[model samples]
Target chain A: MPHDHHDHDHPHSLLPSDPALRVKALETLLVRKGLVDPAALDAIIDTYETRIGPQNGARVVARAWADASFRARLLGDATAVISEMGYYGRQGEHIVAVENTDSTHNIVVCTLCSCYPWPLLGIPPAWYKSDAYRARVVREPRQVLAEFGLVLPEGQTVRVWDSTAEIRYLVLPQRPAGTDDLTEEALAALVTRDSMIGTGLARAPE
Target chain B: MKEPVFLEPWHAQVFALTVHLSDTGVVSWPDWAATLGAVLAEHGLDRQLDGGEDYFLAWVAALERLLAARGLAGAADLDDLKSAWTEAYLHTPHGQPVRLAGG
Candidate 1:
């Protein structure tokens, strides 16, 4: 079943060693036991691959960039605003939007566990879950951001939000200069997953 | 509360695997709960004390035990894969994706 669908161009050798084999072996063994359904696994993968993830969050950011009223609403009530856009689910039931201003920069981390806005982010990055990040981000937000290649102005203050099971956070990164003419769709293309987490900045206009 | 946020792709894969196994009657929720509880007890994992950092680690350990007990996978297979990943990670240059050589 693992090798049945080989339509994608991804080189099989490029996948991570341990996880890939483990998954494959587990799937094969389970299927043999008649205990697991391949279709269910496929559905889960399809959901993350095609239906959910950073693109949804990008659209929200793009809309905020294009509409002042919507931005205000997003900042004031992220859960309700995101729900209005049909992006509320599971880990994203309660959402909070933190805006990055000229004088202030915001970043998010979950010290307790990897609590995140799943409906928006799909899945968190590996570094986000590493013990190093979980322990250090809250204590040294600026240093962590710098490690991600984001060096803010000396005058700007860094604010770090600790996401929990009760509430999740999304960083609204400041729009870069020279993007006044870009359409909302173009603006969305600039929003990366790291920017929403506050570890990296949005892509600069090229 | 809500399910834990999956950081690595592997985390989600493991989760989906478990859920599918349960849904298909390969493993029941009660069986998983008992296995996970035993694992936590063995590790002396106190949620309040650990701050929930090792939740997924515990889950993986329990899953491995379940598979082994059910004759689905052996310890050797899991260890071999773990070693391969460790080797790949060690050889991989910073910022490059880790992949096993000759894989």
Candidate 2:
């Protein structure tokens, strides 16, 4: 007990170290000040939490897997084709769809910052914004993918796409084998969020 | 291991606040992205951000800067209100909702 400041609680030390409290306080302040509409804030949060998410990307992927012509259009102009399906907005402008072929595997990383296609993918996962993933994925994609339990074949090439604010990417994963009989809705179920992110493959038929 | 998109409630709240601000034409998305980008670059140089508390803290900081620039709120105002909320919560008993005066 040499020099413990908390031994005697000072008045100034009453401030909680929790940032969550601070954020709530800030929100209250903003609302009181008439700066932001509380309803609007709730609406935005609800949209991200409920309406928008990787499910949209999964549908896009499933469609591409089920329809060859749609796949070609998606590959040609992802932004235009994706918007046609009513999935378009901020953070997803100028999207480029990169298909995962037998010889080449494409992965996305925002080395500088987390520049993701929010409309299609919704909020990016925590790992996507981590410094380690951002720094290492481009340099050693095979190693990174291995950590994600995705081991590519010896002949397959690993292509890392570093996303930017102006341009974003969506990886179209290869469809699992023996899923030809699967319906588009069922195909959508097999498409996991990571499949579109290129860190993991689509779920196998079960 | 699969992780949640937002680690904390405040993370989503702050993010939503920024989006709401953008939607209302209070600030443009480009400006918000640029501010957050600058903040990330500034704070990310030393610490290894895991997109958890530290990441959202930076987001709050960037939001503060944007709000200050737009004259919506200033640093002093945020600090004062934070202190007031701290006082309110400290006096509040356990399992009770903390409220500001007349709030």
On residues A83-173, what C-alpha lDDT tens digit does candidate 1 reach at each position? 9999975567789999999999989987655677878988676567655687788888778878988889999999989887678999998
lDDT of 1 at A58: 86
lDDT per residue (tens digit) for residues B6-73 in model 1 = 55566667777876776566776557756765665555443322424355555677788898998777
Task: Tell me the whole-model lDDT of each prediction, alpha carbons only.
Answer: 0.75, 0.84
Chain B TM, cand. 2: 0.89
Show pairs that collide, candidate 2: none
lDDT of 2 by residue, A1-206 (tens): 34556635543334445676667766877788776888888887888888788889999999999999999999999999999988887787789999999999999988766889888999988788888898889889999999999999999999999888788999999999999999999999988888999999999999
For model 1 chain A, the run of ten residues with the poorest summed lDDT:
A6-15
What does the interface RMSD come to for each candidate? 8.3, 4.0
What is the alpha-carbon RMSD of candidate 1 to the true structure? 10.6
